[model samples]
Target: MEILDWIQDWFKDNCDGNWEHGEVIQITTLDNPGWEVEIDISNTSIATMNLAWIRNDNGKEDWYGVKIENQKFTAAGDAGKLKFLLGLFKEMIDKIEA
Candidate 1:
């Protein structure tokens, strides 16, 4: 599924009023391009995750950064990295619901 679709579906399936009241997910568009995504799962079983895409970085394209657990872990990569991150989120949701 498309990332946006997955995001919507995930929220629909997981949020139970309180999560939405807490503002669990946020997305903002950068001035240049790309997006800044913040997911607050700290209240949940999983940790918080932040994702941002750099328009241009030292002549590199598709540069993205991810910080988890308030920078307890960090990574930089491309779009594929976001896909992997989403997969991890799905797994966490499944585990928590199960």
Candidate 2:
């Protein structure tokens, strides 16, 4: 199946309880045939952190991202880790292109 389809299914299965609706903003395909799927949740306030497993030509790689902080989620640990994941994503994409 296509990456987009897989992502949609995965999100639907895992995030159905959290999100009411959302949209895919962009899908950047790397040279390795892997993709970066950028989705924007409509209910940003209600939306929680995304702990999805990213797969490339290599294998399954996990990533965590979100911009929300509440007592229920992410009270401890590093919230800035999301930025680091983005940076790593950029580097991986660039490397694939190069």
| Highest-lDDT candidate | 1
For each candidate, give its TM-score against the true structure.
Answer: 0.53, 0.26
| Predicted candidate 1 versus true structure: per-residue lDDT over 8-91, tens digit per residue | 877777677676786577655554444556676655555544434323344343656655656222334444355655555565
Candidate 1 segments exceeding 4 Å error:
48-60, 70-98
Candidate 2, superposed: residue stretches over 4 Å from native: 1-24, 42-46, 52-98
lDDT of 1: 0.56
Per-residue lDDT over 8-46 for candidate 2, one digit per residue giving the tens place of the 0 to 100 score: 554564465545343423444444323443545343333
Worst 10 residues of 1 by lDDT: 71-80
CA displacement after TM-score superposition, residue 42 of candidate 1 (Å):
2.5
